[model samples]
Target: MLRSKKGYATALLASSVFLGACASTSGLDGINDATINGSHAQAQGAMGAGAGAVTGAVIGNQMGSSKAGAAIGALVGGAAGYMRGRSLDIKAAQSVAYDARQAGYQAEVNTAVMQNPQTNQSQQVFTGYRVLIPASEIRNQDPEATRILQKTAELAIQADTEVVASGPANLRDSVLTMLNLPAGQAQYVPSNDTKVAVSVMPRRG
Candidate 1:
């Protein structure tokens, strides 16, 4: 009986420490900053711990071991909460990157959804960018043109979009190769002229 009492006390002490740690790590100021910046993992972890404690306490009470139950629950819940929060952060970053690219390019970013014709079900296709690069720019090695193309590629990666280039056959082919895109995935426009236009489309699996 004495050993049981000691175990219960130990469990309660551990639970208190865990709760205290969470509170200190995720204070109100921290949470507010994370929410404003779209980085909520820390806040989510704290919230998860609190929620887990309550749930654990209830379950433990039913089982006559509330403290131990609460401690274990908090650990598990905190991990799951962090993952959910990280996912949200990634989505927010993608959105910001897409918007910035659109504004800088002064071109509308095109989005399309592809559907399975047989099943009549729709799947979201690649969010992509379409831009026209002049043939002269490529020939003269214009730094601004190069920067724009490079930035476009970077943004596509950040936003998880695909690239489509249509212009001088040679330029289009070179860009496609530089992107390491599969030949089968690229759609090239046939032109004997110097003007080149490229549109980055999302890769389909």
Candidate 2:
């Protein structure tokens, strides 16, 4: 009887230790971010760690030895965490960009493409620029937002005409107009994901 009690205690201790480690590491996995970003790809979660921990614990407890269960559980949990994290990160970036575009900024979504530079062999190239333009300048162009929109449309058309096709002036214009600056209102692009608004404390009436 005493031996059985001791074994139970040991199993409980081991499980607790494993769970504690999981909690600590899971935070770093960035699962929450991946889910929010909508870019997480769950590769091992479904079959690996998600199921492993539970199975590992149950089997280990019944068998009065947690080593087997803990190992399997760790493996499964790790994979799930990784996939979940990645997905959220992707989703977050997309969401931010999509909102900006809908509000009248010409937003673009693209990834690196491979093309040859000198040799015929393909080479990877980075795309997209995080540009910053003052809102005051945008407002001065045309309060109507027409000139900018038409310009962007034209740029896009021109790019399509090109064989390799990469025209960003229109894209730049769209972003500039999205600020919707009034007489004195101005904005600065602090980062790719954020914009800053600046205005004179005095009104020019």
Candidate 3:
């Protein structure tokens, strides 16, 4: 215990002498503690600004300023427009046209018209397409399958009749089934026929 006390007292005496020597230094002694802290803060700020400038330059190079921005904007905008063009209504018109041909009819598409389902809002007007089919194709088939195909065709037609577009399910399925209809001049009879629904083959993901 005595030795520990002696050691601590000697350390304090040495620190006091060191401080006293520093107190006699020239202009450094005139500077205050706040000045030292302020100097360190200024150095940190300068380093931060330099780093920020480099990052900004890199970003500018990649994205450009105006012209490059316009190009990128146009590309994205075009892709969005194409996707919108393939919306259900537009596709339904093509579907009906294609499906009619699949059913062995000479089909032609007429421009389609679309309307707003609400409050007679007409501004959403867009042209729809139509298919002109021959009546002979419906003449002979199992009544059940014939009815399904006819119903689907009608649904596809009705969907585009005014404005609202129907989903592809009806037309797609019917087209596939019509393409596969057995070739014969047989009349439809419900008891022997199955009410099988035709489906549109989906695109591979």
| Candidate 3: segments with Cα more than 4 A from true spot | 1-87, 112-134, 142-205
Pairwise TM-score winner, candidates 1 and 2:
1
Q: All models: lDDT?
A: 0.49, 0.35, 0.32
Q: What lDDT does model 3 reach? A: 0.32
Best by lDDT: 1
Residue 182, model 2: lDDT of 36
Q: Write the per-residue lDDT of candidate 1 for residues 1-205, one digit (tens) a residue.
A: 4544564565455434432332111101111111224335566667877887787677666666778657755765564454344434433334433443443433334433333221233322224445555677766656656666665555445434456666666676565544454345455676776656655543443
Regions more than 4 Å wrong, model 2: 1-51, 58-65, 104-205
Query: Largest TM-score belongs to which candidate?
Result: 1
Candidates sorted by TM-score, best first: 1, 2, 3
Q: Which stretches of candidate 1 lie over 4 Å from their true place?
A: 1-106, 112-126, 172-189
Q: Name the TM-score of candidate 1.
A: 0.38
What total of clashing residue pairs does each candidate reach?
A: 15, 21, 9
The Cα error of candidate 3 at residue 143, in Å, is: 7.5
TM per prediction: 0.38, 0.28, 0.24
**Candidates in order: C-alpha RMSD to true structure:** 15.1, 17.1, 33.0
